[model samples]
Target: MNIDKNSVVTLHYEMYDANNQLIDKTEEPIAYLHGGYDGIFPLVEEALQGKAKGDVVEVTLTPDDAFGEQDPEMIRIEPLDVFPVEVEVGMMFEADDPETGDVIIYRITDVADGKAVVDGNHPLAGMRLRFKATVDDVRAATQEELAHGHVHGEHGHHH
Candidate 1:
């Protein structure tokens, strides 16, 4: 069936960096609730609209459309003692954003001189991305799936 509002769409996608280097790809077909549910990128959803099984779509996303530009303000240096235990580079911790009270994940990028440098920006932030996807299936979403704003069942969310 053609993809449309409240449809459950299944597809596999490959993501590449601006250099054409492969960044990520789905090993299995994943499903999402279509129609501006935020389950998939808006631009990609737009491209998939009215498409049917076996249709392919390719989209290039700027930093803003993708992970977004890296924010220097998200980086912070804190005393080593502030950490609960020995911290190493690449470790991740969750903390509340002082300004918004939203949870933020901070990754330790450096450890030295009794301090740890943590960055909250997504690793892929500030880079252009190319997404190519092939539609594998499309069907009407179940009432529960639509109400939850996501897909559920095989390759979908489990309650």
Candidate 2:
């Protein structure tokens, strides 16, 4: 079946950085309720429209279209005592955004001199990405799936 609005699409995808280094790949295919439900990247959804099983698509995304540009302001240096003693580089934790009061995930990038550098930007932020996907199956989405704005069953959301 063609992938269109309300279609349930199953596909395998590989994500690579600008350097062509594989960042992520689906070991098992994934399914999503197609057409603007935000189930996948908008650009990718657009590329998949009208495609059928066995079709392949490759798209290059700029930083803005992918994880977004890195915000220098998002990086802050805080007193080490503010974080757990176990905090170390590469550790991620959630904290409230002082400006918006929304929860923001921050990753520790450095620790020294009683201070820790925490960055709120997504790890992939500021980088271009290449996405490659192969359509494995396509079918009309069930009413329940459409109502939920997502796909259900194997390779999809469980609940």
At residue 130, what lDDT does model 2 achieve?
Answer: 98
Model 2 per-residue lDDT tens digits across residues 1-159: 899999999999999999999999999999999989999989999999999999999999999888899999999999987765668899999988888999999999998898899999999999999999999999999999988999889999888
lDDT of 2 at 10: 98
Candidate 2, clashing residue pairs?
Answer: none
- In candidate 2, clashing pairs total 0
Displacement of residue 90 (Cα, Å) in model 2 is 1.1
Residue-by-residue lDDT tens digits, candidate 1, 28-85: 9999999999988899999999999999999999999889999999999999999889
Q: What is the lDDT of residue 23 in candidate 2?
A: 98
Quote model 1's TM-score: 0.95
TM-score of each: 0.95, 0.93
